[model samples]
Target: MNICVFCSAADLDARYTTPAREFAELIGKGGHALVWGGSDTGLMKVMADGVETAGGRLVGVSVDFLAHKVRPGVDDMVITKDLAERKAELLARADAIVVMVGGTGTLDEATEILELKKHGLHTKPVVLLNTAGFYDGLKEQFQRMEDEGFLPLPLTELVFFAEDGAGALAYLEEQAGIQG
Candidate 1:
C-alpha cells in the first residue's frame, strides 16, 4: 500500500517523534510505500528516514517553493505548483492516509482529506494517529458534529482515532485488505 502520511515538518519532542518513527518503520517493514510531503527535515525527515531504513519506498509530493527541501533520491518525487496540487498528488498516489502530530498545515491537510471523503470524492481509509492525546479535542469536536447531525456519515466512518502507531497501521492494513 502507498500510505500517505500528513505530519509536521518542524522539529518535535521525542514524545511525538518516537511514535512517528515507530509508525514509519511499520509502514516500511510491511513492504509498503510511503506517499508523503517531501521534506528532509524534522518530523517529516524522521518518518522518511525510518521508512527508508526499514526498506519502504518513499514517494514525495513537494510544493515548488519547498522543492529544495525534498528528500534526495526518493523512489519518486513530484513538485506541485502549490499546496492544493500537492495534496491532490499525495492523495492520488496513496491507497491510505495517516495524519500524525503537526501544526496548522497538518490540520488543514487532515480536514481537507476528510471533507473529500465525506463528499464521496474518494474512499481511501484515513487514520488520525492521536499520539500523546494530541487529537483528543478534535475527536470531541467531531463527535459533537456527528451528534448535531452536521455530518452525514457517522464519525467512525469518516476517520479512525488511534492512540498509537500500531493501531493506526493495523486499521489501515485491515481497511486496505493487506495481510499484515
Candidate 2:
C-alpha cells in the first residue's frame, strides 16, 4: 500500500517527530510505500529518512516553488503547479491516509481527505495518530459538528483514531485487508 502521511513541517517538538519516525520505519519494514509532502524539514524529513533507511519506496509531491525543500534521494517525485494540484496528486497516489501531529497545514490536508471520504469520492481508510492528546481538540470539534447536525454522518464513520503508530498500522492492515 502507498500510505500518505500528513505531518508538521516545523520540527518544533520531539514528541511528534519521534513517533513520526517510528511510523515511517514501520511502514517501510512492512513493505509499504509512502506518499507524502516533499519537504525535507521536521516530520517530513524524519519520515523520509526512516523509509529510506528501511529500503521503502518514497513518492514525494510538492509544488514547483517549493522544489528546494524537497527531500533528496526520494524514490520518485511529482511536482505540481500549485498546492491544490499537489494535494490531488497525493490523494490519487495514496491507498490510505495517516494524520500525524502537525499545524494548520496538516489539519487542512486531513480535513480534505475526510471530506473526500465523506462524499464517497474515495473509500481509502483515514487514520489519525492522536499522540499525546494532540488531536483532542479536533476530535471534540468533530463531535460538535455531529451534534449540531452539520455533518451528514458521524465523524467516527469517516475516520479512525489510534493512540500510537502500532495501533494505526494495525487499523490500516485490517482496513486494507493485509494479513499479518
Candidate 3:
C-alpha cells in the first residue's frame, strides 16, 4: 500500500521526532511505500531516511515554487504547479493516510482529507496518530463540529485514531484486509 503521512515540517523535540521516525521505520518494514512532501527537513526527512534504511519505496510530491528547496536524492517525485495541485496529487496517490503531530500545515492537510472523505469523494482510510496526546485538541474540535451538527457522526467516523505507529499500521492492514 502507498501510505501518505502528513506531518510537521518544523524540527520538533525528540518527544515527537522519535515516534515519527519509528512510524516511518514500521511503514518500510511492513513493505508499504511512502508518499509525502518532498522536503528533507523535520519529520519529513526523518521519515524518508527511515524508509530508505528499511528499503521501502518513496514518492515525494513538491510544488514547482519550492523545487529548489526539496531534498536532493529523491528518486521518485511528482512536482505540481502549486499547493492545491500538490495536495491533489498526494491524495490521488495514497491508498491510506496517517496524520501525525504537526503544526498548521498538517492540520490543513488533515482537514482537507477529512472533508474529501466526508463528501463521499473517497473511501480511503484516514488514521490519526495521537502521539503524546498531540492531537487532543484537534479531536475535541472534531467532536465539537459533530456536536454542532456541522458534520454528521458517521462522517466523523471516517477518521480513525491510534495511540502509536503500530496501532495505525494495524488499522490500515485490517482495513485493507491484509492478513498477518
Candidate 4:
C-alpha cells in the first residue's frame, strides 16, 4: 500500500519520534510505500529514514516553496505549486492515510482528508496515530461531534483512533484486506 503519513517537520522529543520510527519501520517491512510531505527534517525525516532503511519506498509530495527541504534521493518526488495541490497529490498517490502528531500543517492535512472522506470523495481508510496521548483531546472532540450530530457518519467510521503504531498499521492492513 502507498500509505500517506502527515506529521510534523519540527524536531521533537523521543516520545513522538520513537513511535513514528516504529510505525515507519512497519510500513517499510510490510513492503509498502510511504507517501508524505517530503521534508528532510524532524519527525518527517525520522519517518522517511526509518521507512527507507526498512526497505520501503519513499514518495514525497513537496510544495515549491519548501522544495529546498525535500529529502534527497527519494524513490519518487513531486513538487506541487502549493499546499492544496500537494495534498491532492499525496491523496491521489496513497491507498491509505495516517495522521501522526503534528502542528497546524499536519492538522490541516488531516481534517481536509477526513472532510473529503465524509463527503464520499474518497473511501480510503484513515488512522490517527495518537502517540503518547497527544490526540486525546481531539479524539474527545470527534466523539462530541458524533454525539452532537455534527458529523453525518459515526466518528468511528470517519477515522480510527490508534494509541500506537502497531494498532494503526494493523487496522489499515485489515481494511486493505491484508492479513497481519
Q: Tens digit of lDDT per residue, candidate 2, span 1-180?
A: 999998888876778778878888899999999899989998888988998788799999988999989988788998899988988999999999999988898999998999989899998999989998999888888889989998887777788989999999999998889986
> What lDDT score belongs to each candidate, Candidate 1 first?
0.95, 0.89, 0.88, 0.96
140-174: candidate 4 lDDT, tens digit per residue: 99999999999999888999999999999999999
Which ranges in model 3 have alpha carbons more than 4 Å from their true place?
A: 153-156
Model 1 CA RMSD to the hidden true structure, in angstroms: 0.6
| TM-score of each model, in listed order | 0.99, 0.96, 0.95, 0.99
Model 2's TM-score against the true structure: 0.96
Off by over 4 Å in 2: none
User: Per-residue lDDT for 74 in model 3?
Assistant: 66
Q: Which ten residues in a row have the lowest lDDT in candidate 3?
A: 149-158
lDDT of 3 by residue, 2-60 (tens): 99999877888999889888988989999999899988888888888898788788899
> What lDDT is reached at residue 105 by model 1?
96
Better of 2 and 3 by lDDT: 2
Between the candidate structures 2 and 4, which one is better when assessed by TM-score?
Answer: 4
Prediction RMSDs, each to the true structure:
0.6, 1.1, 1.3, 0.5
- Highest lDDT among the candidates is held by which one? 4
